[model samples]
Target: MTAVIENTAGQGTNTGRSFEEIAEIIGQVEDQSRVGVCLDTCHSFAAGYDLRTPESYRQVTADFDRIIGFGRLCGMHLNDAKGELSCHLDRHAPIGDGHLGLEAFRNVLTDPRIDNIPLILETPDDTRWAAEIALLKQMAL
Candidate 1:
């Protein structure tokens, strides 16, 4: 099973806000593959891990790779946050329609490191899912 780091409100004061924290949690186990991480874009931003620009995306992902390793990245929850950065809110918004812009998504969908993993949408508007998926597909190219 994969362990997803949640926002502070969900996981309390010392939530797995950083990859280092999650790494610590993952270290206590015997079998390394027993746990993996499913990164949530919204939760991550709310937790203060910026993904708004290409540079920010690179830095944040580099931190993740350095701390947790990409081998443990099981999947991703592709979401746009209704709340602003570091707000600690769990609100989900339609892609590119909230605090997170399209550029943030462009950075993510095009990243080759996560190419083979399942990328699930957690955007609030179910009606826009198809269009959102299409937009993401275009970004990947």
Candidate 2:
């Protein structure tokens, strides 16, 4: 089972709030075959993770690698956030159309750790899914 972070309430509610807790739970399991994680970009940002800049992105991902192991990264939800960082809101925004700028997603698209996992678009604008997909592809290359 992949322990997706429940970041809607952030620190307000403590169920799967941070990667550290997730790491403490799933990442420490002796049998690692069944457990993993799905990182939601919006939830992550809302939960106080900064991925807007290249350095911050690298730092956040490096933290993930160190704490949770990149091998346990099962999925990623690629969505921009509507609220400010650590706002603890679950609002979903289109890629590059919210608080998280295009650079944030560009960093994600270019990361080699993303090659194996599925990148899910949790954006609200399904009409622009094709355009977003194209943009992400371009960014990836």
Candidate 3:
């Protein structure tokens, strides 16, 4: 089972706000091997974990690896944030059109560490999903 971390800024509860928190929750599970995390790019960025540039991406991902083993990353929600860095907003823009440019998506899509998991899109505007998917596929190759 995979647990998708939710944003805590807008919400009253403080569940899954950081990698440490998520890791702690997963660690408590009886079968941690079967439980994994689903990272949402928008929510993460909104929570202050930047994934835009290579250096920032590396640092943030390293932090994630240190806190919540990369092997436990089972899935991802690929979405650009409409809010600025550390804005604490849950708004999701279409891939490449928001604060997180196409480069961010490119970085994640091409990363070998997360190559095996599914990348689900949570961007707004259902009409542009086809185009977004196509664009991401193109980037993946």
How many Å off is the CA of 28 in candidate 2? 7.4
Candidate 3, residue 2: how far the Cα is off, in Å: 5.3
Model with the higher TM-score, candidate 1 or 2 = 1
lDDT, candidate 1, equals 0.82
- Which stretches of model 2 miss by more than 4 angstroms? 1-14, 27-30
Tens-digit per-residue lDDT, 44-103, candidate 2: 998889999999999998988898888877788889999999888888899988998899
Which pairs clash (backbone N, Cα, C closer than 3 Å) in model 1?
A: none
Please list the Cα RMSD from the true structure of every candidate, rounded to 1 decimal place.
2.1, 2.2, 1.9
TM-score of each: 0.90, 0.88, 0.90
Q: Give the TM-score of candidate 1.
A: 0.90
lDDT tens per residue, model 3, 45-92: 888888888888999899988998888777889899899888878888
Q: In candidate 1, how many Å is residue 11 off?
A: 6.1
- TM-score between model 2 and native: 0.88
**Model 1 lowest lDDT segment of ten:** 2-11
Error of 2 at 32 (Å): 3.2
